[model samples]
Target: MGIKIVPRHGKSLKDKLYLPAIAGGMKTTFTHFVKNLKDTSNLKTMSYPEVQPEDLSERYRGVHRLTKWDDGSEKCVACYMCATACPANCIFIDAEERFDGVAEKRPKQFKIDLLECVYCGYCVEACPCDAIRMDTGIFSFTGSSREEFVVDKEYLMSNERSKDLNDG
Candidate 1:
């Protein structure tokens, strides 16, 4: 096959100097600065932790949470689908057969390393039973040690309070 070469577009003297691009950038910056100065409340910046932003979208995925069944039991069937789909492999599951036989299996130990997680939402999509979701809206998390970031099954199951935050 022959190589097809595309012709390069020629630039004028003004275009080669890039003065117009610089002026356009300066104009945009000055306009925003003047607008923010005139009405500070219109500024997009927010003083976080104390005064959270009110412009979070509906589809904003935050922290992970384990869903519950009608009987208040965990909805996860311990199928390992979530761990398999996770690109970061942050999810850890230790499955055990259920005694009640309501489900074939249940996670004896489930943990997710927040530090290693990329927040890609693959686990949520891979779940067959609708047991996992990233809709808690608890994005702002702080910890002094790495151990704190490793969320266990109990933490994920009892994360209802996190969703109540208006800031998130």
Candidate 2:
């Protein structure tokens, strides 16, 4: 018994070169350019720094902040819910018993590596006590080193909601 092999056709010169795809992309670009030239009102581009967006959606998720009670104590009960729910595993916390009786436990150490965080708001959603929020409206952040980007408990607690992106 013998096995017969079937011959397959190779890609054409145009297919190999991707000329059709390139032409399609160029056509799209030209069409959009001409449409934009005819009607510039549809453009949503903004001049940043000099003129910021007047309104950011309420649902906009920006920087994370740990909320505090009226007496200035952290609202977090050290439940570890936020850390567990974070898909990026950016949150780190060490809990200690609270002898003061304000809460059963408090975070002895809490840190969030912004670089590792995806900013998906999972931590905020997981906090049962509403101890964390992403309402600072700080979309832009810069750090000199990796250590600088890891915000500690104090930094997260001190972070307040900004009136605008520039305010933060």
For each candidate in the order shown, give its overall lDDT on alpha carbons.
0.88, 0.90
Best by TM-score: 2
- Each candidate structure's TM-score, on Cα atoms with residue i matched to residue i, is 0.70, 0.71
Residue 153 Cα positional deviation in candidate 1, in Å, after optimal superposition: 0.3
Per-residue C-alpha lDDT of model 1 across residues 73-145, encoded as one tens digit per residue: 8999999999999999999999998988689999999999999999999999999999999888787777999
Mind sharing the TM-score for model 1? Answer: 0.70
Off by over 4 Å in 2: 1-10, 19-45, 164-168
Residue 1 lDDT in model 1?
80
Question: Mind giving the per-residue lDDT tens digits that candidate 2 earns over 1-168?
Answer: 699998765478877888888999999999999999999999989888667676877778888899998899999999999999999999999999998888899999999999999999999888999999999877777889999999999999989987765454
RMSD (CA, Å), candidate 1 to true, equals: 5.4
**Native-to-model Cα distance after best TM-score fit, residue 119 in candidate 1, in Å:** 1.0
